[model samples]
Target: MVERRRFSRIIYQAPATIRQGGTVVEANIQDLSLHGLLLSTDGNNAELNCDILADIEFTLPSSDIVISLVANLIGIQKNIIHASIDHIDIESIAHIKRLVELNVGNDDLLHRELEHLSDLGEHLSDMGEQL
Candidate 1:
């Protein structure tokens, strides 16, 4: 498996059934990534480059902030909706990471990056490991 630079701070997922113009469809998100997400919607039946997309809102369990994101359906598997984020930014990534650290505490998950923070000095002092 490839090492992920960012991880999902998933709170929950619900069935996303949307309609635009005159068409109706339903789909689900299997997993979410930092830049994009894995959708399992009825996208396989779509043409090579379909633009049928929608905007969705979801809340983060930590901050309870409902972030609305525009997404595009990319692939499909057995009626599952597979989609990706239309646009993502580094600021959003950092916000999610900070929320995770705040809610989950600064244990293994937070300390995983200690090796990279060695130059920060403070974390080095906390770890009781002298440089």
Candidate 2:
């Protein structure tokens, strides 16, 4: 398959909860990137283009990271629900980026991406140096 995303995606699964209004669904993150995340869930199909708030929590090999954000439901295939991040705070963004960098296991790629996000004023600490 041809890669078309504007941002690099890290294949990582973490437990999550999706909430829209008063409805809540348990889910798991199938993949994640700076712009979005794919959620796997068994709940009823969400309305297309609907916005939902979610809390994703997971422990890394070394640390735990939790992210809270509003996202737009973009697509659904089988059990996978794709959502584009509609809102995320800077601190959560940094933690999301760090989680990707750590799980991706690539120093050079993480370095370059950090430099790019940094240029855009969304800088996260480099895990490259620590590795």
Candidate 3:
């Protein structure tokens, strides 16, 4: 497969719950990037173009993280759901970026990604403060 993604992706399996309004579905994330994730479910038929709210849980070297983000359903190939992050917090985004840095194994690329994290734009919310 050709790598057409702007940011590099890494295989990451994590437990996740995807919710759209009252409907909820469980899935395991197969691949991840700072921008989005590809998840797989048994027989979920999530609608395309709908906004999905997800809580993805994973463990890193030190701490366990639960990343809560809102994403739009971009595509679905059989059981795979390709969702793009539409909203997240700064801390969560930074942690995800750090995880990617750990997997990417390139010092210069990590440094550059650190710089790019600040430019992820206004989609990041202050919802953490409310919680």
Candidate 4:
């Protein structure tokens, strides 16, 4: 298989809450990237659906700032949940960017990832307009 990942993932472990409709599940973030995250949940897999969007809330490590975003539950394998961020507030994105920057350690790579994310967002917006 070819590597198709556009963003660098940082190994960040943190407790997170995923809320979809009336169901709320506690999960641990296994890794984080600009566009998505890998989460590990206990036995609450039955409560989540891949077709539904979920609100994920977690605080930055050792900080009081909470990062919240709406994500699409893309896939699940055993206890691991794969989530793709669909919508995030400006503040939350900023926090995530900083976190990635600190962990990635390469300014050029981070810039490239940011540009890719911007381009993807523009492309999606244009697609929406065409519809």
Give Cα distance to truth, residue 40, candidate 2, Å.
0.6
Off by over 4 Å in 4: none
> Of the pair 1 and 2, which is ahead by lDDT?
2
Residue 66, candidate 3: how far off, in angstroms?
A: 1.3
Error of 2 at 63 (Å): 5.6
Pull out the clashing pairs in model 3.
Answer: none
Q: What C-alpha lDDT do the candidate models reach, one value each? A: 0.51, 0.70, 0.72, 0.95
* Runs of candidate 1 exceeding 4 Å displacement: 1-28, 40-49, 88-131
Model 2 clashes, total count: 0
Mark the regions of model 2 whose C-alpha exceeds 4 Å error after superposition.
46-65, 105-108, 111-131
Q: Quote the lDDT for 83 in model 2.
A: 86
Backbone collision tally, model 3: 0
Superposed Cα deviation of residue 124, candidate 3 (Å): 12
lDDT (Cα, tens digit) per residue for candidate 4, span 1-131: 99999999999999999999999999999999999999998867787989989999999878899999999999988899999999999999999999999999999999999999999999999999999
Of 2 and 3, the candidate ranking higher by TM-score: 3
Tens-place lDDT per residue, model 1, 1-131, is 98665444343344444444455555555555433455456553343234666554445555655555666766555555556665434455455456556665655855555333334436647677653
Q: Write the per-residue lDDT of candidate 3 for residues 22-101, one digit (tens) a residue.
A: 66778888888888899998877554334445444444434566677778778777788888887778888888887788
For each candidate, what TM-score against the reference?
Answer: 0.43, 0.67, 0.74, 0.97
Return the top candidate by TM-score. Answer: 4
